[model samples]
Target: MGTYDYIVVGAGSAGAVVAGRLSEDPGTTVLLVEAGGKGRDLNVKIPAAFAKQFKTGLDWEYYTEPEPHLDGRRIYHPRGKMLGGCSAQNAMIYIRGNRADYDAWAAGGATGWGYDDLLPLFKRAERNSRGGDALHGGEGPLFIEDPRSPHEVSERLVDAMVEIGLPRNPDFNGPTQEGAGLYQLTQRRGQRWTTSDGYLRPARKRANLTVLTGALVTRVVLEGDRAVGVELEQGGSRVVHRAGREVVLSAGAFGTPHLLMLSGIGPADHLREHGVGVVVDNPNVGAHLMDHPMYLLNAETTAARTLAEAESPRELVAYLTRRRGLLTSNVGEAGGFFHTTDGLAGPDMQFLAGPAYFWDHGFATHDKPAIAVGCSLVGPRSRGRVRLAGSDPSTKPSVRFDYFAEPADMTAMVTAVERARELLATSAMRGLVGSELHPGAAHTTRAELEAQIRAGVEHTYHPSCTARIGSESDGVVDPTLRVHGVQGLRVADASVFPTITRGNTHAPSVVVGEKAADLLRSGVVAGGRAGQVA
Candidate 1:
């Protein structure tokens, strides 16, 4: 048994930041617990080899229950199980989402969560190689860089988007997000740089900070109306670890809700049926799940130099010796945001272009080279839920995305696919690409395209909002991120997003972690002195 000023579960995307930044006060004792090992694997370090880690030991390997809207097919969700969590496993696209995303959250009852309130934190966490400005950060923990060796397909994809009438904006994390350009990566030089590499490891030497790996938390320990500790299994024993001030649950979208239910802070009737005592009876604990549904349009590239050559011995030698090669590619090398429908605050769809065959999560390979253009529905109106499978902690939760459950979502996706076809037909890709491999040339009509979508649609790996922020009537956590009916507890992760952001969620998750630390430091969320980091 152990005790600390704060116990941050999961050591993931946000939890690592919470534990690391909390211990910055020297006076505070912090404990970070993780179920996985260190995130220094070879596959994790190589950007192009990211998909190799899927369904492996480093992944949580979660699969949703058959989604009714997608022809009752189970969608695979691969969450990083190591120190950095999804941030370590993601494509590392350095996008903070459209400014309107935060404004909408603030407008929807999440006060102080507007875009302006978060921009500085986003800046403070990034160290862009291009240097800082009024909009970007120059000196920060995480490193952002340009792709070291983007293939010909990547450059042509950007050109094709522009040739099809999109602006050529160089920076997606700038004043605007509507443009075709190369994506900056969460990388330094050429290797993948995760939050664990940037934030957690640097703070490990602090005497006040403790990191426990291979620890599986059973549940949060509540005393009366407040969370005081947690029960976990480490090594061969079950143990209890107490917190002096707070127990912050950063176990991510799926794990956080699962832990809350296991701790009896979920729906009263549901807990009762599972033979557990209810502490909060909050029916909103695991509701309102969200994710971006994406369909990849693959075409055989007549031109050479795609990810098909990224794994060759020559490229590896270049990567290992000089850190410059195709291995630095994040796969989603170049793309942009665009509105398929008008009257929206920002672009509703995001294009993720990559120079690879990229199907079945990279398990499917082709004899010839190919280029993949992923049309992702970023502003999905569809919602889903997460439910407990059983009382056991080892049991995974049952999640249902219900993708395309909203007709507007399907309409937007189909339009995006049409746009993709238009981009492929452009002069920029005239002789470069030919013969669509997915949604084949045979499927042309809207109805047939929708069917093709249901048959092969995947996600951008951005799962969030299962434990969203709002009042007690509609949400599990409040504006300050503390659970509504529970005391001395808070959530700082993608799970707390009132609405999922308009782009890759890694950057926003980093901001949430930074803000969470600031809140704890100023004693605002602890309720001693309410103040903003600004």
Candidate 2:
């Protein structure tokens, strides 16, 4: 295969930005490889139809190896496999996590990754419909807009949270995050806008950029301690593509670690068992996994026409003709960050409420029109692990989030349930809501609520930190995102987050790409940028 200045694996959220930004220099050549096809499905464009892509070709459709804490249930983990990755598959919520998250990373030995350091990158990647501010960007690729049509019940949900003792905040991304408001979305005119749209699409026309779809990277081709290129199985043949400067792995939390271990960059004993040569004996390759375990509280709604009728003829007509209707709803429509207890640096929980019966990844539905309020344990102390099931790159890795493994994790979730119940009973929700559908009247006590949470909990789909940024003693990637024992290689996705962000991971992943581009460019020391590759 041909050689390029940079080879970016997995054209997902961060990968798309990495490839697009690197190719900005016309003198540089970049190749972006994606395992899935271009994400152009009609459902991908419709914000409300995001759940329709789950388990489809666009989804990786992964399942965990049975969590021991949650009655041994094998929780489903759906990841985007196509161009924009989860950005094309997510609810389009445009949230950058708490400022404390980045500051913690710098404190934890991830130098130069502080909130002040990355704020510019976040602003640089944005094009808010509300225009520029001290905190937002007005002229960038990513488009963030208010909901085209907000359902009355969704608005009431925000009011309900405020009535239940939270402050009313018009802008969650403004000075503070501890308040209730309708969320802005990553959309333009009611259509989903992904990093693929913001970054990749415009850059694809560049002569120096080459994008290959349906290409699954098997492993890194290492020349001693340096990653020279990547071996990918595209079509029916396995080919090697050389990276003249560097090989950046934006293959996500799971895929990046999987590819690293397959390339003999993991624990020496584990590699020996798989009959593979060991180049680096790092044990932190697939450890320290963390995710926000979420629970949805649904209630029958006699006051609002929920998303059950979103596909009806009238709604369809409105969406088709004007792009303004229930079809434009991003299901978790109105929400805000909150704390389960006081004096925390930031909120430990988030409320994502909407006028819909969202459950079991939207596969399970209710007979009556209803509203759903989802609470995620954003600040969990629990960690998990990801290990290869076999030596084969085609096999999915074995994962277990070990959710609720820490007693505090369960306590916070229970507190979240109590708060959700408070929101449901508030005067703002009195006429709009009915009987509780999940963890109903029977589960009221602390223990009962804990049981209900264990039985009914889901997640916010924010999995991260498997290849976290740390010293060689604790993590796979260093502060600069370079692998500990490898040269000319780096990991630039949620995998490199020192700790999971307290909110959606999409926007931060894009920032990771922007920061990676700067770091790669800054590597020009004594020679030309490409010629300086180790």
Candidate 3:
């Protein structure tokens, strides 16, 4: 068995940051483990090639159980399986969500997690190309940049949004989030800047940090209620690694909870059903699964304004010579936040305008010139759960999003579709856009719209809140991220979010890692028992 000061179970967004931060002190030794290969694929570096990684070796490619509300359809959920996790395989959008998201968590039993408390960590971890401001940081590990060459179609869509009375806000991560604007990306000089690239890579050269790829953690090795170490499968060999300080689980929303259940730390009944002995009996371990449900509205373009034309020799040469052109696009180039109704806390609906036919999560692309807008319910009331399919570690978990189960969620989606249609019909989009290809004009009535929504609803790839941070009654982890009823174990990732953030979750996931590092470093070790961090 090997030992270390800290053992981080996933080398994704949060794990990368945690290991990198902890190893900064030469006296500390950190271990970061990943189940997938190194994130060195060309598809991971090119911002526009993110879709190509889906269902490939770099993706976990999880799917949810049939949803009753959506005609019993099983939605595809793709997560990053490589070193950088989803950051290396995502659209690279840099949005921190609305401030109210954090404040609400603070109000709802999560102490010390308010917007005011997290803003500094957000700034500290960001290296925005736009330079430092009250709301942004200029010099940090994660790089954020504007699109190198914004597609004309995306620019026109922004103008159309402004013409339709949506305010023109230059920065979504700034003071307010309610507006239409171009999305900043987690990129640098047109190349994707994944957390592994930004944080882990820098620390890999440090003698104190050890990174192991292709290591599949089977379960946490618990002694009574305290996590002593982990058992993993590396190269078809069973290996045990002990942690001297703590065992941090940054295995993401799905992986983390699945590992917990595998270690017999979840609901007692569920564990017994899977023939796994219960340890903690925490019913909330795999519950509270949440994600943003989205539907795409595609329209044919009159001119060659989409990425279809750019996938040519000329564009390829341009991209090879200088990291610019359509290749630099993050697919979902421009988007904005909007409220379906006024007087709400924040935007309930989020829109993304892509310069391609983004149907079926980009699994199938067309030769025709097209532009698509994604309408998603950012604040979904529908909650779901992740349950173990069996006790075997290799078996994928059973995920049920329970999407559209709440009638109000469908109502909001219907409004979002109408808004998307309006944006496509604007004067600015008159020449650029042609006939609607999805959910044609015939589906106008509420009943028809609802049917169409049910037929085409898909996930936004932002699954979170499975193992949330809250009080003991309804929470799995405390505010400091220490797992309830478990010693020497903590969770830091999107799963700990009390509520889903308003926009893409990439930025917030990285911020959670930065904060978690601080919490771990400053935490005081107490009398042979697990200590409190931050």
Candidate 4:
């Protein structure tokens, strides 16, 4: 292929938006490279059927090297390797998280990225089902829709929260986020709306944009100090593709930083350990890994009307004909955020209720009858890292997610699970709940709860902060998202989030892509000269 004006590596969540936005200029030529094949799986399109995609060929299926806090069980992490990436396989919840999250980044030396500054970009990138306004966007390429068939159990879940004195937040992405309510989905009608469907799909019709699926980018080829192209492996053949202007790294939190490190952009010591030559001895490249840690509080439910039992002919007919019923429900229907105590600045915990049991990573195949409510620590203090398992680019990297490494994380998780149990004890949830499954009533004491939390907690799958934005002293990428020691390249995605937000990260990740695109198009890098490549 010929040299393009811009080369966007990894056609995942953030890359889709970058390619979509940059190609809109018409004059600029953009190329998007995806490692996996087309993301057109039936399970990917069906909002409720997403769990089926896990561990499939389209998924990366990464597992963290045994977390010491989780009783030495290597938690399974399923990342999409398709065109839309995780967006194609994730629970379709749409959340912007707390506004304080953005403000905190600005306070941490990342200028012009506070809540107020980033709101416009968030609005510009979304087209909500409720339409556009000061808080939401309507005409944007990304489609955000309401849940199609929200089950009655979803309402009961919210009612249980209210019965336990929690307020009802009609919109989690609205003025307030501290309450239980039905969550909006990243869907368009009954179908899933991934970044590819919202952004890249439309951009493909444009002559200026070219999307190459199943193309594994091995490294970001650097010409001395400047990144000028990418080396990709296609059908066992190595090919070098050049970029006329700049290269954008939107390969997500894990992939982007991994690619950078492979191209000799991480710590000098780690580079030598992996037998890779050091180009820019940046010590903070793959550090500061943050992810949302959570645990499930399961109870056998008396409610016969659940997706768990909806495998009947009637429900099958409903799904097959009009795509309505319990089968259409996104497992996480109703959710909430609450403070562990009064006088706190924001919510310390979040809740996600599923009408059916999720034994492993998702729903089990057997006739196990249970309902689950999961609690996730919104702001975790623990940190971890991602390192090369080998020098080979195709090899999966070792992810050490040091969950509950901090006392605050364990405290928050225990409190959240306790709150969930307390809510179920209320009359609203008592009508449906039968008996505790994981940590029963016997595990109520502080010590017992703490132990259960340490043993039972797993990832909410919101891993970020590998290449976070901040001052050069503390981050891999600067406020403008340019890599610290690398020139002509930028990293955009959840990887750039200094601290992981308090809600579903998909919407926020898209927002980052939107803002990063604007910064690159406006010719403004961290030091004022954008096109000059650092």
Cand. 3 TM to true fold: 0.98
lDDT of each: 0.89, 0.90, 0.88, 0.84
Off by over 4 Å in 3: 525-534
lDDT of 4 by residue, 225-335 (tens): 888899999988989898877888988777878998899999889989999999988877878999888788888887777777556789878877887777677888889
How much is 424 displaced in model 4, in angstroms? 1.0
Q: What lDDT score is found at residue 31 in candidate 1?
A: 91
Q: Estimate, for each residue in 1-534, the C-alpha lDDT of model 3 and write its tens digit.
A: 899888999988788888889999898888888999998998998888888899999999898888899998888989999989999988888889999999999999788889999999999999999899888898999999999989988888898888877899899999999999999999989999999998988898999999999999999998887888899999889999998879999998899999999998889999999999998888999899889999999888986646876668888877878998988998788798898887789999988987888889888777678888999789899999999999989999999999988999999999989989989989988888877888888788989999998988897889899889976689889888888888889998999999899999988899889988987888643333343232
* lDDT winner: 2
Please give the lDDT score for candidate 3: 0.88
- Which stretches of candidate 2 lie above 4 Å from their native place? 524-534
TM-scores, all candidates, are 0.98, 0.98, 0.98, 0.97
The alpha-carbon deviation from the true structure for residue 89 of candidate 2, after best TM-score superposition, in angstroms, is 0.4
lDDT of 2 by residue, 167-205 (tens): 998887787878999999999999899999999989988
Whose lDDT is higher: candidate 2's or candidate 4's? 2
Predicted structure 1, TM vs. truth:
0.98
- Kindly report which residue pairs in candidate 2 clash with one another: none
